[model samples]
Target: MLLMHSQVKAKTPPTGLMSNTEQDQQFQVLVEQHKGILYKVAKTYCQDESERQDLIQEIMIQLWQAFPRYNPQYKISTWVYRIAINVAISFFRKYQRRKSSVDLSDPPMYITEPENVEKEAQLQLLEQFIHELRDIDKALMLLYLEDRSQAEIAEILGLSLSNVSTKVGRIKEQLKRRFSNHKI
Candidate 1:
């Protein structure tokens, strides 16, 4: 159970406006409602447990900063996804530059093995296949697997609808080939 850091608590608006408790409450609710977005993004981009926690904190801080300026017309989930994905990409890139060693043996912390051994192996393979994708494609696939609409994915990724569709089809084919090649 992650709590908001004190540093990210509601701050006075820049225009000499006092902080509104009501607005703060609203922001808190927004975060509570979409908290999974933070975790999923963090897990996808970070392999280390501590790094994932740091990434989630970073995402929360950014979300707090941007909350006041958030527009109401757009879907909240879409807004949250956009911010989380962008932060994860930047964080991953920074960590990659500083990383000294690669650890491929550890499974993602978010994955829980199913009862069936074959199913668990396939799930692990799928996760590996997803992690191999380019950053943008990885974001796209995450959103897609979450069952977001193509229109929503396009909006989140700032790609054209056709482009989103084309890339998704290609990624699916690539994953299929990987699985096929793994078979004896």
Candidate 2:
């Protein structure tokens, strides 16, 4: 079970609105339910372990700040994706500016039993390829791989359905060429 850290403190609710305790409870429930998405986004955007955790924390903070303005008409996942992706993109930009060169070293492997070595290898290769994509494309590909519908992806990314379709097709072609060239 995912638990919100103590760092996520209850904030003052808007006047004539839900109580702070009620708002915090609702936010906690939502965060717990969607934490996996947060983790995936953070990992995809930040390869450094410490930076990834910081990104996740930043994402949660931004989510809480924006929670009061959240519109229920949208799907919860869509809202989460929007906030997470925006935070990730901003964080990526800031990190890029701060560092003269980013280390592209292979990520640490975590295959203890080695039962699915081939599968793990393929996943790592895919992750490497994903990290090479542009920020928006990375978000789109992540959402697609997560089995989000194209419509949902379009909504989250603020792209038209046809544009999302085109981008996915192009992204797949790019990935295919990259894999073939790399002989993965």
lDDT for each candidate structure = 0.73, 0.77
Error of 1 at 15 (Å): 13
lDDT of 1: 0.73
What tens digits encode model 1's per-residue C-alpha lDDT throughout 1-184?
A: 1122332432233112435665566667667767777777777777666667667777777787887776545667887898898888884444544332322233445545456667878877888888888999999989988999999999999999999999999999998999999985
Model 1, residue pairs in steric clash: none
- Clashing residue pairs in candidate 2, if any? none
* Best model per lDDT: 2
Per-residue alpha-carbon lDDT of candidate 2 for residues 43-126, written as tens digits (9 for 90 to 100) = 889887667766777788789889888765677778889999999998444454332222223357668566778777778889
> Which candidate tops TM-score?
2
For every candidate structure, what is the RMSD over all alpha carbons to the true structure, in angstroms?
7.0, 6.7
Off by over 4 Å in 1: 1-19, 91-115
Per-prediction tally of clashes: 0, 0
